[model samples]
Target: MRGDTSNYRDLFLGDVPMMDARAPIEFRKGAFPHTVNLPLMTDSERQKVGTCYTQQGEAAAIALGHRLVSGQVKAERLAAWADFARAHPDGYLYCFRGGLRSQIVQTWLREEAGIAYPRVIGGYKALRGFLLDTLDRALAECGFVVLGGMTGTGKTDVLAQLAHGLDLEGHAHHRGSSFGKRVTGQPAQIDFENGLAVDILKKRHAGHAHFVVEDEGQAIGACSVPVGLHQGMQRYPLVWLEDSFENRVRRILRDYVVNLGAEFVAEHGHEQGQLLFAQRLRQSLDKIQKRLGGLRHQQLAAIMDAALAEQARGGGVEGHRAWIEALLTSYYDPMYRHQRESKAGRIVFSGDEAAVLEYLRRASTMARRPDPGTSA
Candidate 1:
């Protein structure tokens, strides 16, 4: 049997498999990327045990937990765990605090199944704390550049080309706007932060001490940027990306209308997918109604609805350009212009896509070059 581990760095770096022995509710609330939830007790059982502990103390809780999970129930759980152990001999098991639940699983595996699997030394809490610390350290020590542009300038496309780019919106499964919601839901807040931290950790390990991240607000849909990262972004050097008004309209049309509709259809099939996609577009416009004001909101929504209808009838996507251009000119452009003006002092480079990409790549290359004048 392998010993329990507290080597959080190694675990993340190696992408080790993990069995979460916490309740399903706890796992749903927050969990690592590759970890699977194989609960030691169901949510109901956990609730009863928690109540027993609160009312009668540890011993009563312990007794009640055992009684609740005996006979066939116990055997079934044991089989599941044994199967996991046999399948992932390199993985570790964990509970919330690496306490009672994990210890029980470890013990049962040893005694009943003749297998001794290791548990994470401090379990979920410790690993989560480690990720938080990792993010904080990265913020404190690393160099960052924030990419800023008007809507539909393709900031994500630029980031995709850079080795040191951090895709914050991608991590959050959002596009960082009122209309940024995807066909699928965003990750849990904890999951978003964990994924971001892991990405930063992996990049830092690969000798990237500098990164480029898109300029975004504190929250992206339901996911919030960690406090330190958000604060650092406020001060980072700004690189402005630009494109023609016509090109911007086409980009937004492809991303939000055409591509988004296709995603929905692919996930839900043709009929229901088209219905939901149309609904989502209308809902997105409605969300900004207060900000856009009544008459203007009505005007934009009307254009959008008409566009969606035309596309639905197989009349082609050219109709979406009218609404997208109007939205960009009336709504998004004004707000972004103000933001750019406010951050004028921090704007180190301003260019179209290819120029911005070249500048960033050159900057990253220069930053990583060793100083031959200094001793190793």
Candidate 2:
């Protein structure tokens, strides 16, 4: 029976002969489609069991679990299982593994209600194996197009605007920066990968010629890009966006305001935010610091301070544009130039937002063209 249990793909793709069972949190983190959580144990109960395992070993923990699940509580759990089985008549059940806990639940469900819930042979472990296998397959077979640029080039924004491609940064809920945390929350590492896997699967299913993604380091915020996927990305041709320093700064300011809102300026206080932004500016100016030393940092800081104050005082378009351009030319441009030169296989596309969007659209269309002599 265990040998005949369905794989995760079969279950998630709705090919399963039965409904699937897992815990609610686990299901939310990642789960097969059409799955249900009939938690044999609550979150606190699971935590206590884990603590017992660490302090008292598996045998003692198992005994404690049995002891804790007794009387009315046990009866209620059995009743819930009966209800679930009725609702999902052809459902199968699984715990972390096709182990004793699952056996206990299966036996109770059968004895009390005369309903048999098939158990996944290796349970969650088998599902994990399936996910890993699928990811590896995707990494090996997919054609990737890497979008590369320095900070504040709006690489993510451009990627989003492009049609028919995965947005890796969006999936990770990060801007891929020193200060990239979302205003809401970040996804757990497992959840991030699960979302990424969904995108990869969708692209593959569509027979996409290639999927576009931002050029990212090994990790994005709290989530680590899988090694296989990272390697796959590195092999693809790179598309580098070139923008004027003035334009880049304007873009960054606009992005920050849009994503973080006026409250960001208000919360940090215009003066403090100005100071921090200047400090970042100085760091970006480190190459010239040796010749100019402390004086350079101070000069840039002062300029940044004044510019930020103007913005605070409602320095409309001109003031904002001037400040952003100064920082970009005096800092971002040089840094990006050095880094961009070091990268290989780059196809440079120079333009403002609309022009860049047009370039990507053209590239995507060309990639999708059918091979000559291929059957209709």
Candidate 3:
């Protein structure tokens, strides 16, 4: 018999042992949860086969693949499969598709080792389908609370402090911004959503507390947010953060400079990026230039220039606080005022970071409280 194929859906839904038969590079790009690599072909082997397929056609590549897998190599692979099967007796395995690679491994496990582990019907493709479907369903069912504020209001930092659930924090590894990409590579979009799905499922299973997340505008670096989730965030209830311009700039410098490191900025042509950032900053400042005037903008420019100089000199935190304070007061504050006036929402509560955390805590508490009308 075919063992029990009926449990495959359940296996996929929950965590189940799986294997990626692709090269390490392909696997690193994205992979299913609980997946181990048991590649039939090594990285160079796959590349060679691919080159043959392109140059010599399918027949030649297939013949070469067969030749490569025969003899001692095949015996060692069978031994490894036997070990893996013994370790994860109930596990399923897959390749890019339900193809020859999976068949060879499945046969070794079942026929030789007498261990039955069904292959995924469509392999990684099926897992991709499931991930997309789950994310779409989540978008429709879940409530979202968008955390919005000007740069350096510590929106991401505050999200961490709050007890509420977050989807993007762990996957992106940094707050979403032009500089969001860290020294480490980000998770692939599929892996990001995989992590996101876990967060969403946990929140839903706990009950319908609104999921708190930062107001990211679609794509974050190389990874794109799922369209459904992105759409939901736009219409969701929003909590706008308010902070002193001085304080906000201070926070931005502290967070970005200290955490990101001065060398990072220098290595990436920090001065040039800062100059461009200043131009954008100047445009935002242009709206209020009538009130603050060109001289104020120039003063702000001078402060930013000085801060960059201090950073280049590897100066500590001394001059940074005062410079950031001036930029926020003279620049970032007025822009926020215009934004606040235009926003539409029942301002549930507002204050600095502490107040935001307090509100979220209260909201979470209310969500968990038993309703008087519904009996347990």
Q: Rate the local accuracy (lDDT) of all candidates.
A: 0.91, 0.65, 0.67
> What tens-digit string does per-residue lDDT give for candidate 1 at 165-214?
99999999999998999999999999999998888787777777788999
TM-score for all models, in order of appearance? 0.95, 0.67, 0.70
> For model 1, what is the error of residue 313's alpha carbon versus the real structure, in angstroms, after optimal superposition?
1.2
Ordering by TM-score: 1, 3, 2
Greater lDDT among 1 and 2 belongs to 1
Worst 10 residues of 2 by lDDT: 367-376
lDDT of 1 at 221: 99
Distance from true position, residue 282, model 1, in Å?
0.4
Q: Clashes in candidate 3: how many?
A: 0
Error of 2 at 131 (Å): 2.3
lDDT of 1: 0.91
What lDDT score goes with residue 67 in model 3? 86
Put down candidate 3 lDDT per residue, 335-355, tens digits, no spaces.
Answer: 666666666563456677888
